[model samples]
Target: MKKKTRTRLLVITACLLLFGLFLRGNPDEIIPFGLVIGGAALIIYGVKNRRQGGQPTVLPIMTKEKEAHYLESGMTEKEIEFFRETMNQTKKQILQLQENINQNAKLKAIDLRHDTLRASKALFKELVKDPQKLHFANHFLYTHLPNMVDLTDKFIEINGHEIKTKETYEKIEESSQIIDQMAALIAKDYQQFVADDLEDLDVELSIAKQSLKRDNSL
Candidate 1:
């Protein structure tokens, strides 16, 4: 069960138990039924969150631009739908991190990487057309992006306590470095795709020019 869901259930159960006792009823009998219902609700919530990849807060928003780009990239309707959901979830996480960065000056390092994430996201939208490139891009789109978001959120949570110990400082430093590295790797992946496309375009243009010259000679 997710920690929040479990905590909520525990609080509800405790409150129900207190209420039963206050009424001078059989606490054991009253609490058992409440516990069973709460347990079921917790199980349901946990399953739903698990299916959502533990991001219960993220709502999938499919933008028109995303649809147009995906269609232009030759993705089938089904693949477009799948990738849309993936992109929405990633966008939610990235937006969350961005909002946090804006609010927290201590998270300046995370803020610095925001542009890299955005650039990589744009490249990813373009590169998804090629299955071979998409295979590698998945690491940035699915894994590393989410990891950076989670790490930033956790770091912010840790900082909220205002406990400035050496251990906490070290953790903050480590997280900053890791987030920076992930940003660099994502940027590098996107650049590789762009470089490949540019090279191919150059070759095609050269071939076309040579063919035109040969025709003129003939």
Candidate 2:
């Protein structure tokens, strides 16, 4: 209530009380009754919403541009660039390693030529005693070895960084598929044979020298 309004009401009540003879109702009772009504309403309103001073929750409004700014602040320039470059470099290195493996396979093919020659000679000399066997051996030696050598050699040529024809590519694929195992098996056996031959030749030479020394002593 305003001070002026309250003062006016007090004056009215005071005047009524001073002249109770003219007023039927008691002025003191009226003033106290009005005061009680006002006080009760205030107490009810205060009690109904009495939460203990917690702050109100309010959501902030943000735009996409502001969200992008927040993300950018969390990441540095070098970190982003490094991630991009690392991915690119890793993909490049993977391609290069695949090329390297292809080249290594070609090199392994080329190395088999030595074993092919040895096995071809051995088969012609030892396994072809009969006429029919000889015919078959010759046919295999002529038809198979040359084709294998040519095919694998083409791959070796590619490993040396040259391009080949489609026909040559097909031949390489065919021969490599077949002779992949043959080349390895033959190469190991031929190497062992050569090693044994050299060892025997050394032993014979040593024995021959001993016999010569013995004859000279006689």
Candidate 3:
């Protein structure tokens, strides 16, 4: 069973137990007893199933339509699978970073410094459109992005402390600077990744201008 399903069962059990207690003084005591027993049994079953490792995690699988789309884009099955896994991991890291930013005012300020979260999400969207270009984003996907997540996690951890000495303050300041730098670098990564596309647009514009100039001269 999924954790969500298990939690739902536990919640229902709690409600049953509460209702059973409420009905304790009723003329027909059997209903209350039955409810209490059923609730207890559910709790026991949930605990046992959890202890036995409820279920294996299910990985995302590409459907035939998605596979065909990627195939048309010249991606092999292996490359498509790799793209799925890589994007999945990247998305999770981005979500964690967003959550961290929401939790900490400092991180939120850093994100606003250069719109880091939005830039990261934009990068992910671009990759989804042309996953074959994923090779160009190895550093962003594997190193810089992961580093951003880790730094934010540590920053949140240290910032959560009730007491802070001078050294603690210095460490927090240093971490904030580093995170800001990482944010700038992530923005740069997006720019660099799209540089070629920008160049192509420029070339097309130049060609169109030349054609217009010739038409005017004629």
Alpha-carbon lDDT, every model: 0.70, 0.50, 0.87
lDDT of 1 by residue, 1-218 (tens): 77687668766776766676659866666667666766876777678668777655444566787678767777788886666566566667667766766666656654465566466557656654553356656777777767877887887787777668998888878877787777777677677657877899999999999999999999
Candidate 2 regions off by >4 Å? 1-115, 127-132, 162-178, 181-218
Q: Please give the lDDT score for candidate 3.
A: 0.87
lDDT for model 2, on a 0 to 1 scale? Answer: 0.50
User: Which residues of candidate 1, in runs, are more than 4 Å off?
Assistant: 1-74, 105-115, 127-133, 201-218
Residue runs of model 3 more than 4 Å from their true location after superposition? 1-57, 216-218
The RMSD (Cα, Å) of candidate 2 is 38.5
TM-scores, one per candidate:
0.58, 0.25, 0.70
> Residue by residue across 119-178, what tens digits does model 3's lDDT show?
899999999888889999988999999999999999999998999999999999999999
- The residue-by-residue lDDT of candidate 2 on 105-215, one tens digit each, is 553444455445446456434331222232333334444444445555555565454666787677667656665654555455434435656899999999999999999
Tell me how far the alpha carbon of residue 202 in candidate 2 is from the true structure, in angstroms, after superposition: 29
Q: Report the Cα lDDT for residue 36, model 1.
A: 70
Please, what's the RMSD in Å of model 3?
Answer: 12.2
Q: After best superposition, candidate 2 residue 46: deviation in angstroms?
A: 99
Clash totals in order = 0, 0, 0
Of the pair 2 and 3, which is ahead by lDDT?
Answer: 3
Candidate 2 TM-score over all chains jointly: 0.25
